[model samples]
Target: MSRAVLVEAPRPTIAAPAAAEETPAQRPSRRWRRAVSPVVLVVAWEAAARTGLLPAEKLPAPADVVAAGWRLTQEGTLGVHLADSVTRAAIGMLIGGVLALALGAAAGLLRLGDDLVDPPVQMARMLPHLGLVPLLIIWVGIGEELKITLVALGAFFPIYFNTYAGIRDIDERLVEAARTCGLGAAARLRHVILPGALPSIFLGLRLAIGAAWLSLVVGEQVNAQTGIGFLMMEARDFSQTDVVLLGLLIYALLGLASDLGLRIVERRVLTWRRGLRAT
Candidate 1:
């Protein structure tokens, strides 16, 4: 008996549009790949407890987390925690963002000003935000003010550094051209330099927002009556890893939401710069 061998030859490269048409069909396959592991993990987890591979007390199923979150929501505890976290993040981000933008603008405008302010700000940025928590607790007494302050400090440097970099990197050629138009230094900065720098500034803002969220968690975890971080800390004391994971998941979603909202605002404000494609 003779056996037939199956062989395949590679297809030649297709044109752009022809290659692109396959993308939509492959998208579902891509999505399936992304989802397969999580689905498998959930199934395995459920099976593990049923098969005595994992004890119910030690490892709860994803269903338990859903139920736990639902119970917390029904009792209004989750809402309160989420609200506290959101409020802290919002207040801190606004304060930090405003300060960074103003100071960065100032430093960018004047070399003497940058010399006076930029060095120390850069130095401070090198220090971790969480490393400052103990000092903050000692100085500010672990209240709402402390929490907000921690988050503000956490957010400030990213925005300031990026904004300053953007400003400093503004093309001298553009400045010279603007100067030829009878544009004053202030006018050049406000109209030309700042506008040119907006994209970098927004990138910094996105980064600072992420920093703010992280610092908020640390602030709440260390000392607080409320917020998702506090809930997770308390859950840890009770060995409720599921609750801890749930809190973490919620905070991740909140950060994602905040970043998405910021992106929307950024796009609207920076629409003019889109043509430049500096990104």
Candidate 2:
């Protein structure tokens, strides 16, 4: 007891933390999966075309379509047609989107505005806008104006409805919280409403772009002298199936490209969205 040693307990060894396994990112795998289905479809299509099960006049092989597209590209016809179609769509979308934003904001924020604007819009939406093409042509003539107007009409309602819905759908609690914090109307709208509505707006944007393309398809097909639809029609008259398919492929590609662009924009704009976070 007298010789009690004040020996310190042996210091515990602290083990080093293990390094995290360097797992590869799944991005490349996801991209590979997306490519797989389309590649398989293309292979099957080429194989079927070689089988002669369907006449070549009806469905051209993918290779033939690519060849025809290349030929058109070399001739500079494809560029001109693509440019015209894109210009019409862009102009129409801009006009329609501006109108929609104004109308949607008014209707969504004010009951009187909603009563005055929403019902008529809903009624008009029930009616087929494409059927109005004949009348549109009669009034506007078969020109650039006709195509642009048709695209505008096609794009308008989707934007209007979606924007209105987005605004109306904002959580009431969030609005109350903003009010409790003494936020001014402009501040509340800027910080709360607009952000809340953006996802819906992007959804509408995608749909509207598709609709614009669809309307352009119909408009261009009717008494059109230029654009991809006209090119397809011209090819049809000569039974140039490859060229016709190429035109269709171009339309599909354009629509896909536009949607991809919007998706990129949405991802950038919605970076704060928690659901986008991965574990």
Query: What tens digits encode model 1's per-residue C-alpha lDDT throughout 69-153?
Result: 9999999999999999999998999899999999998898788889998999878878887897788888988789898998999
lDDT by residue (tens digit), candidate 2, 31-80: 79789989999989988998997578899788888988898899999999
lDDT of 1 at 265: 93
TM per candidate = 0.79, 0.89
Identify the leading candidate in terms of lDDT: 2
Those runs of model 2 whose alpha carbons end farther than 4 Å from true positions after fitting are 1-24, 276-279
Local lDDT at 222 for model 2: 85
Candidate 2: 10-residue stretch with minimal lDDT: 270-279
Give every collision pair in model 2.
none
Cα shift from native, residue 149, model 1 (Å): 1.3
RMSD, each candidate, Å?
A: 10.3, 6.3
